[model samples]
Target chain A: MLKIEGVSKLFNPGTVDEKIALLNANLHMKQGDFVTVIGSNGAGKSTLMNIISGVMKPDAGNIYIEGTEVSQLSEYSRSKWIGRVFQDPMAGTAPRMTIEENLAIAYKRGKPRGFSFGVNSKNRKVFREELSRLGIGLENRMTAKVGLLSGGERQALSLLMATFTRPQILLLDEHTAALDPARAELVTTLTENIVRELNLTTLMVTHNMEQAIRLGNRLIMMDKGKIILQVDEAQKQGLTVERLLGEFERISGKKMADDRVVLG
Target chain B: MLVSLVGAVELGLLYALMALGVYITFRILDFPDLTVDGSFTTGAAIGTVMTIAGSPPWLAVIFAFFGGAVAGTLTGLLHTKGKVNGLLSGIIMMIALYSINLRILGKPNVPLRGEANIFDGASVLTIGLILAVVAKIGLDLFFKTNLGLSLRATGDNSRMIRSFGANTDGTIIMGVALSNALVACSGALIAHSQNAANNSMGIGMIVIGLASVIIGEAIFGAKTIFRATLAVVLGAIIYRVIYALALRVEWLDAQDMKLITAVIIVGALVIPTIRRAIKSKSIAKKRTEEVLSSMGQTSGGGS
Candidate 1:
């Protein structure tokens, strides 16, 4: 479960280029709620995600994870309850480090890291089993540097690493956008399966309209720093791409102007 | 000739600790730390001052490591907490250390004459060898620990490590502190070995350390932490041996030692770039030739 109350973020405040990224945004999710977010660029989608993950703070607002106020916590401290897969696959994994070593870091997420050996027999077996589950044959290349893997493989690995520890909340920032269509589809399915297996409460920001509509129990759309629409699970099933754009036009009084929204 | 050869090896063994320190910051953390220039003298100053006050030689060297750690921690704090640039923090620390070292020594120079230096008894070369190997083994083991993995990850991809619940600022500080500690340890030994510590002994220390690290990686390859550390050790020895050999040139003056070091580092860095460029050029020419021949064949077919 997660809660955001009256969160507002302003960038370059008091400057000539002053911009409002998020304005009094409110979002809530119960246990195991999967919510997909979509918006135009600069629509404060990422700003909202960043606030929740503690990467950036809202100028005015409070965030609570499971009733614990965490607006004041640092990113690393808040990471105990939050797992993130960034848009850039390279951003989620160290290239020079081996696949197993990267997994070791993820396994100890939310736990105190210490002087213990990182890649011992016990953890190596766990990592191998988990990699095998990805069905990418990564189980056999535990010692290979992550840099050698393709973007799709890295994204798959990143998804596995983020959810393996079973964090309280999952944040995906267009995690599959960079992949080819087939790879994106593969990662998309994996994301759904892993979230279901772990029963994780997740907020996925996506550019693809169909993906936003197809996945998750609930959906929200943002425009001009505000959550303009929220559709529940039952309503989402009847919705199609044309109707979604119609809803966007009805709410914002403008067509989906961002080429990426229509293109995606 | 044999005596100078043995002496070069001895010097190499002592300075290898310094190179290992440089390796941690340079290769491991990807931080170009200038604290080496000051920390080396900080170690020598502390060791000499303590030895003058009647402490055992080895104890002085141990304290010197602590002194270097403190100095390095200062730079880390300046960079991480103070929000200063990485290079500037190192420069600031290196400059501040000069005054601090002078204060510790209470003079510009200190002599270890008639003192029971750690390398005084039995074979100095054996002492150097034991000290260097012990330090190398200790470093290699440290690199395998969980904390060490996080440290390496911080250098490689700090954002990824932070998302996995790590404070990169803490790891960077720890790395810099450990690096300078080893540098000071080497300085302590060198001061005792040569019977004196001078104010200018630390000049160009970073270059020498970088040279050693580069030479080692070039020869041994750095595919693994263990191999990399060994390369650093061997590189230090090789650099010193080459320095000795360069000095034997009849026309080369003693004053040219620094110049020789500078040239070696320049050559080491530039030669690789040059060779890679030439290799790429040859490949380009071959490709161009093939393209021209294909065009010729097409025209011949048309004719």
Candidate 2:
């Protein structure tokens, strides 16, 4: 359902601080494929996600969602086929807006937004039912500002918002990184349930090795702007953190020194 | 005193339109648009000129709104398309508007020369109240629409809204344009009431608008958009009343009005912080009492 071909991105091409964020990156995913990506700092994990989401265009190749090339599309235009959850809980939802208002916005994603009233009785009922599904009692406070919600609640709401329109692809950039342990677990469970229930084609970037291995049908390791390793579902069944570290050392010729990846 | 109070109410209602415009940019869009200082004058200039040119009063006022909207759109374009900073973009448009307003008026000021204006058919208070209520209701209705939700979201979180497939640039343009349009309308109304449009009439307009919004939100609270807009209107009236009362002092002169305006704004801005501090201190005192009472109960039980 998604194809990325030979994407390259060079930041500050000629300056002293020039860095090749992505080089000839290539990936393809089948429909309903949930893939987890893991990498250390500056491994171009976010750059790849940005390119796929059209937040930043790749300097050299084409990206196709359902066989239609979208490399030239603007971020807002490309968003018709893509849903994203950012790392910061505050980044994925508008704080001052009410829960129902935020959902109304997500419900109309990729659709024409015209003169219709935003939150009518019908949609308000729909939003109430949907919020109840979160099991967080948010339905009772539909008019409450999202800023009043906790980080985990906001992230869960963001996930629901992203999947409400059922985009062609969902990009999650370390979405649970900001929450406390219990909240993170709650969000992680919600993410799994929502992705499974919707059969969504998702690409999740994570710093946690166990989560990287435990979730997703496919796993990929990235380093220095390249996809260094890939493991299918069969291979991932027996994958261990130690083995993954060994593989990283063997291929990149450097120790995996990022404590976040190891400790997380 | 009674006549001054009535005059204050009329002036306050007229400036309420401008205050509402400021509320959109400053409170809703989180944009510090300096364009108000110029666009307010732009409305006055355009409306006054049109009135002098034999157009109907209502038509002239409507034209002034469109004129201000266009000026606001220019600022939005300069900011979004030209990649200029928001403050710089507004400043640039404001400076350009000075020359544009001059061209429209053909001079620094223009007198109506007893030309029939909107207030001629109605009392100033009645007309001002009607127009202000219409603008407020119109704004309230517009904000309930889908486009308005997107605009509010754009101000709250542009990146998130973009990810949801909304064009933030368009929303920004629309918001800034709408804000200035209302401001200019207020300017036109003021010009009609005063019987003249001066180039310097818009000076300190942003400050006054900000003061009204701050005072309104501080006194009345901004629980909802309706309340917020209502508070702004009330704040404008209260501000005018205070100005009128200050003017009654024998030592005060007309030139000191700007200083008074500044002081009023400062006082309004500090009120919230002061309230918070006082509440926190009271809470601390209560907490100490609770702790001491609990300790005394435990000691009595042990004895």
Candidate 3:
């Protein structure tokens, strides 16, 4: 379970270009509840995700994961309870490191990395099994540097790395946005499978309406630094792009601001 | 000639330890730690001062390593906590260490000519070889540890490592500490071998260390940890042999060695960049020609 209490983030507060990224926003999620978030550009979607993962601290507010206040914790400290996949493919994996080496680092997530040898027959076997599950032929090239992998393959690895350790919350920030259509579809399917297999409590940010409706138990729509609407599991089954857009225009009294949200 | 050759190998092996220290901060951590310029002297100062004070020379060597490690730790804190630039942090520590090294030495220089040392009546070459081998093997083993993997990841990608819940600050501090320890130990050994320590003895050490690493990686290739470390050790010896030959050049004074080292490093770094640029340009040209020819056929014209 995860809780965000009245979080507010201000960017360049007193500057001429000051912006209100997030204002008094609050969100809560139950365990194993995969919630897909769709929002226009500058909707503070990434900011919300970053604040939860401790990449950025809120100007005022507290975040609790499994009943522990992680507001004051550094990003690395909060990492114990959070796993993340960034929109940028390069953000989630070390390119110069080998495939197995990256997995070994993830395998010790939320635990103190100690003097034990990083990769052994035991962990290598685990890594091989996990990589094979991705069905990417990665198990055959455990020593190959991650830089050699394609974007889709890398995204799959990122998803696996974020989920395999089984953290309290998994944050995906437009993880498939950078991939081509086929790769994006592949990663989207992979994400659903891994989350279901692990029953992970995942919060994903996206611009894709179809993806938002097609996956996850619940969907939320945001605009202008606020969660304008949230569709529950029961309301989500009947959700369609036209209906959701109509609802957003009816509630906000304005057109959807982003073209990608319309097209995606 | 044979005596000079043996002497060169001995000096090379001794300096190899320092070079390995440089490789850690520079190659593994991707942090250009200028602390080497000061820590090397700090090690020699501690070793020589303690030896003169009648402490066991071996014990002095150990203390010297700690002294350098402390310097490295401060630099790490300055970078991670103080939010200073990595280069500036090392420079600040290197500058501060000059006074610290002087304090440890109690003077500008000290002679350990009559003092007992780890090399007392022992074969210098054998001792140097043993220490270098031990240091190399130790590093290879450390690289296999989980902590080591995180440290390597911190250098390769800090963001990625942080996502895995590893504290990069802790790893960086540990790595810099370990690197300077090796550097200081090498400094102590050099002091014992030379029978003295001077305030300026550590000057340009980063250049020398870098020269060894660059040369080693270029010649032997760093495809694996074991091969990379072995290359560094061999590179140090090769550097010293080249130094000996340079010393034999009547036109170049001993003071020219540092300048020569800087030039060598410049060449090593720039050569690859230039080669890559030319290679890439040629490849781009070839691709353009192929595309242009295909377009020429399809469009019935080439613009």
Q: Judged by TM-score, which candidate is best?
A: 2
**Interface C-alpha RMSD per candidate, 1 decimal:** 0.8, 0.7, 0.9
Model 3 misplaced regions, further than 4 Å: A262-264, B276-303
Question: Candidate 2 chain B, which ten residues in sequence have the lowest lDDT sum?
Answer: B113-122
Among incorrect, acceptable, medium and high, the docking class of model 2 is high
Worst 10 residues of 1 chain B by lDDT: B115-124
For each candidate, what is the lDDT? Answer: 0.92, 0.92, 0.90
| B1-303 per-residue lDDT for model 1 (tens digits) | 888988999999999999999999988889989999999999999888899889999999999999999998998999989999989999999999999888998889889898778876757789889988999998888876788888999999988988988998999999999999999999999999899998779989999999999888877888888889999999999999999999999999779988999888888778878988999999999999999999999999999
Residue-level lDDT for B151 in candidate 3: 94
Model 3, span B168-221: residue lDDT tens: 999999999999999999999999999999898999999899999998887798
lDDT of 2 by residue, A1-264 (tens): 999999999999999999989989999999999999998789999999999988899899999999999998989988899999999999989999889889999988987788788999999998898888889999999999999999999999998999877898999999998888899899999899889988999999999898988889999999989998988889999998889888999999998867677444
Residues A1-264 of candidate 1 have per-residue lDDT tens digits of: 799999999999999999999999999999999999998878999899899998898899899999999998999989999999999989999898899989998988978888888889999999999999999999999999999999999999999999999999999999998888899999999999999999999999999998998899999999989999999989998989889889999999998877666334
Best by lDDT: 2
DockQ of every candidate structure: 0.81, 0.83, 0.83
Alpha-carbon deviation at A82 in model 2, angstroms? 1.1
